[model samples]
Target: MSVFDTACGQVRGSGPDRGVVAVLGIPYAEPPFGADRFRAPRPRSPWAGIRDCADFGPVPPQSAQLPGAPSWSPGDEDVLSLNVWTPAAADGAAPGGPLPVLVWIHGGAYTFGSGAQPDFDGAALARAGLVVVTLNYRLGFEGFGHVPADGADPCPPNRGLLDQIAALTWVRRNIAAFGGAPGNVTVAGQSSGAASVACLMAMDSARGLFRRAIAHSAVGPCYSPELAGHLMEKVAAEAAVPATSAGLAAASPQTLVKASDAVVDAYRQNPHSGRHHWDPVLYGPVADGVHLRADPLAVLAGGAASGIDLLVCHTTQEYWLLDAVGSSAKVTTEEHLNRFAADFGLPDSLTQGYRGLMPEAPVGDVHLALYGDLMFGEYSSRLADAHARAGGRTFLSRFARQRGGSEPVAYAWHCADVPFAFGNLGEESIRFLIGGAPTAADHHLSARMTAAWVGFAATGEPGWEPLGASGGPVRTWDAADTTRAPAPGHWSDSGTVRTLWRSFGYRPLRP
Candidate 1:
């Protein structure tokens, strides 16, 4: 049933059980198609009648090769839509009372992903006494490509970021009617989603839309204007068209998709030739003057977002899942070891250091640990340290519980903590990760973690002290026990590892 009608003439929603929810998929801006295809987002037209809020609206155009599932096109161009979940009836939630609102942005490396993934069901989070919202924005070339204009003030790149800002603005204006506290909002996301949260923190347009943020795997890399232009040119050449909005927009969607796929295929075959050696899909945020002032790490190091509370973390065995997928050939010899070291940009000394640490471990296991630390651990630790240095309230954690059925050595891989965080331990994806069925211990940890997350959204504190506070504490969640203290040896020594990483030019990438 409809809960409330938004100013844009879209009906906000409620869940099936009659519990309070307002799934508003209002268009914050006009469709990015036709003449507006690659231009900056413009304000939506004011509407005259209530719009239906029955099903998820069209996802932004993206590649079908997104991780974790098969992708297919769901044809429609109204891609700018948002879904909201709340706890009170539309008309009569105390007028000024505040309830925390959590806004989730999905991750797909800036090219693919949607708010409609089964794993990101906001129902559980909403049921736990908070309002949850998720939304879709443009992707691929449509969201990021730049076109020259003859205006006095040129539009900076990063139209995807602009879409996110627009969505947040919509929340600021309309969420309160669905029992959400416009003043107590929290922005949370994973992977590129986390990167988007970091960008939002740095963007002036996003200020005051949310009071706190939870950035899981927060990335710190952005594309330079030259680099983005080069990639766009390559895509245009592959499509046999001029590198302009008019030229590319005239091509059919299938033709554009094929051209993009061909470019990625070529890169995959000879990675060193392209700008994105490792991933063709890595089109991150750009440092356009208006949307992003500088790289997020630099901004964080300079105490940006100092006033906001943050919960930032990483999985312990972050790279094992990728290894399991990419290299079925187990690392068995020193030759294999050396190859992996070069691939992941591990320093010779650091590789030696890990070799010493795991003298008896398999070469593959060592490689997994090394890459995991490089990709997630060091960055997460640095983020915590940066937040602490900036005078922001930051709570850091490491998920160490190994999935049940997999090899005991697998540890907590990427996205492993999501099920526990959302209290969906029994879902198919969660069960696949945890093996068979979730035990009582799983339920307990889920409740505790979700409570901590909800608590963070509610207040600046997340049931733990900041990493570098006077108490010098951080949380560690495991199956055996969950506790907080001066971040155990693992988190504290990340700076040393990070230093070693820098020597090899293995910079931490953020968006």
Candidate 2:
């Protein structure tokens, strides 16, 4: 056991397994419940004595039950805590100066996830000579559901985002005590968490908190206040309450969670429910024009994220995970494919272009390809390009590592790259995502991926040339060929998919 002082007080942590001390479950803010419910995070009241924090804290109000991670039952209030993994105080390590810090935000849409998720364990990164921090924020309706303002202290919108910001503020103030450089910090996440990183780049309060960012599979981020309001109404309807702050707040977290899930089921069952039918995820950071100035794409293109060094990554087949897990809508016939295209306002020419690209592919495959790009791939690429064009230091990479060319195949789909990047390929729970046990080649790829992350967090360089709107190297991580990164030459806009989305405008997902 080891002890370290934080702004709150001293904490005892377990570690030095191989030179890393992890201080888990330290409160970064007061729990957002009771008087603080549906509100911005309150600063944590300092503690007086040594707090034993050997295990992870309680998660937020979420319904997700990730394998090998704790699940949320009702009344788990202290969800705004964070964990630190560092070698600064580990056994058998010489004393060193402050190390670069990498703060992680977990991705489970905007509804349910915690820093305790298995893939986010920070020990590997800590071993690579960087202090790693992961945190939990409010999820589901409690964190993101819309509410009416009360007098001068209008309950803030994007309260989940606010919780994340509060955590980062805590890191800025207290990370140095964990042997981290307060001035040097990088924020990283995947899926919705990646979107949060993008939002943080464009946010005023989040400025100066992170000097660099790493976003993998950054899904769309932008929910208009009207859309947010409507979802709240639906949730209220499910809970049998009035669609007001008081009514929703009066309900229990368990009730709200069940209500929100019912609303999601309603959307999932009704094909005409618009975009939410395809993706029933109900909460997101509201672009209320105050906290988040605009949609992430527009904000980044307008240059708000220019000063931050950015690293973007996305898998080649992002939507397959959703399809495999029976989470996404499947389009099989030509009529449904056409309707799917029209649903998102995709151009006929673009659909035809994709057909030309993959003529033999079934309607479902075509739909997945187009839908994945619309939701993740194309959007993520544009973010990188926009940041680069606006004068930000940016790098882009694509994960294409797969299993056997023959038997027992696993596509380089969403989340498959995470465990590899984190170097936890041997874990049993994660093996299902990465397609069974890893091989020597997979281990090599994991090392390279981990090294790239270590290098970028340490120095803002990920072993590839800085990307630009016109041209730059794209580091390709592949197990098939571990000898070289990015293999041969690849273009900045090489694929037909890029040209198809050249002038497309992104809109908020609707119900």
TM-scores, all candidates, are 0.88, 0.96
Runs in model 2 with CA error above 4 Å? 88-96, 150-152, 406-408, 480-494, 509-511
For each candidate, what is the lDDT?
0.71, 0.85
Candidate 1 structure, TM-score to reference: 0.88
lDDT of 2 by residue, 358-422 (tens): 77778888888888888888888878988998889999888877676734368778889888888
Please report the candidate that would top lDDT against the real structure.
2
Scored against the true structure, residue 463 in model 1 reaches a CA lDDT of 78
* Tens digits of per-residue lDDT for model 1, 1-511: 6547566765745455546555646577888776666667877777876666756766776656543433536456777878877765434374457578899988776777888766677777877778888888877776776554434235447888888888888888888777788888899988778878878888878888888999886654666677677777788889898876566667655566677778877876673442243445646788765578876766776887888888987777777766665522346678866765666556689888777666777887887777677656766666667777888888888777775453563458777777788777767745556555787887888888899889999887667767664336657677765555533244223334445555643232322
Q: How accurate is candidate 1 locally (lDDT)?
A: 0.71
TM-score of 2: 0.96
